[model samples]
Target: MKTVILIGAQGHMGQAAMTGLKKHNVITASRSGTGCDHTVDITSKASIKALFEKVGPFDAVVNTVGYCEYANFSEMTDEQWDTTIQSKMVGQINLVNVGLNYINNGGSFTLISGILNVKPIPMAIADATTSGAIDTFVQCVAHELPRQIRINVVNPTVLEEAWDVYGEMMPGFQPVPGALVGKAFERSVDGFITGKVIFVDA
Candidate 1:
């Protein structure tokens, strides 16, 4: 059984991912540290490094958390933009950068990205931009990783489980089941494909 590190374990998406990964030895982590095995602040590289160091060797890392600010394009502030870039784009990237040291050879890294990048909506410019950036980052970095390590990003649309919170903003977009999204991550962790964006849109 592969030892997996699952970040953002307390969130809805994280819980969805946990469904499919239940068979594995999954280590749950989150920023709040409530109801999870550990706490980690993805925005801080030092926190990420510390988490990995404490966990020791692991076979895979699945990150289901990244925050982006939502605001009208015209009203968006510099701080909002910075928050999106730092948390969604750079923070996820840092996971790969720092995790290389502790992950076992051939281990995989699975990151979360939303469908906003391809399917745009109002007031989500920052989120869309960062989502696109994450997809691109995974596609490019997959070629450079050593020791047969693999990486992929899961770009799922609004989940059925989260529709109540995000449905109105998404308009006609269909909400997919969390189980389907979880399977995508399972594929990335157990399969050989790398540098791919596994989309789970119903």
Candidate 2:
């Protein structure tokens, strides 16, 4: 089985991914610097570098971390924009860049985006922008990555477990189970396709 490094291993998506990736040798990480096998703050390049160093080589990297602000586009503050750009956009890419040397040849990188990029809501400016950026980034980077390292993103809809709080906010669209979304990440890690956005529709 392939060795996988899973960042953000304690979140909702991360826990779901862990279940799907159970067959593989999965290493879990969190930013709390406790409980998990490793700690990483994706927003900091230095922190990312250290995590990889401690962890060593791997066959795939799966990231289920990131957050975006929800607010009126007009009133969105600079801090909100920065938080999304720095953590969601830049942080995910940094994992690929800093992880190049640590991954085995033909290994894959699976980043998480959300369906918000396609079915945007009223206050999803930050989420939409960052999700869209990650899609473009993977498409662009896939062409130039050395060592045959693959990269892709999983765009999942609102999760079933989280529907209680978000159900009223998101109408019309059904919430997908996290396990169903985990299949997309499995495809990215185990399949040969790269630069594709695997959608988890509900």
**C-alpha RMSD values across all candidates:** 0.6, 1.1
lDDT score of model 2? 0.90
Candidate 1 lDDT (Cα, 0 to 1): 0.95
lDDT of every model, 2 decimals: 0.95, 0.90
- Quote each prediction's TM-score: 0.99, 0.96
Candidate 2, TM-score vs. the true structure? Answer: 0.96
In candidate 2, what are the lDDT values of residues 1-202, reduced to their tens digit? 9999999888888977776787899988888956689999999999999988988878999999987788999999999999999999999999999999788999999999988889988898899999999999998899988988999999989888778878887889899888888888888998899999888987
Model 1 CA deviation exceeding 4 Å by range: none
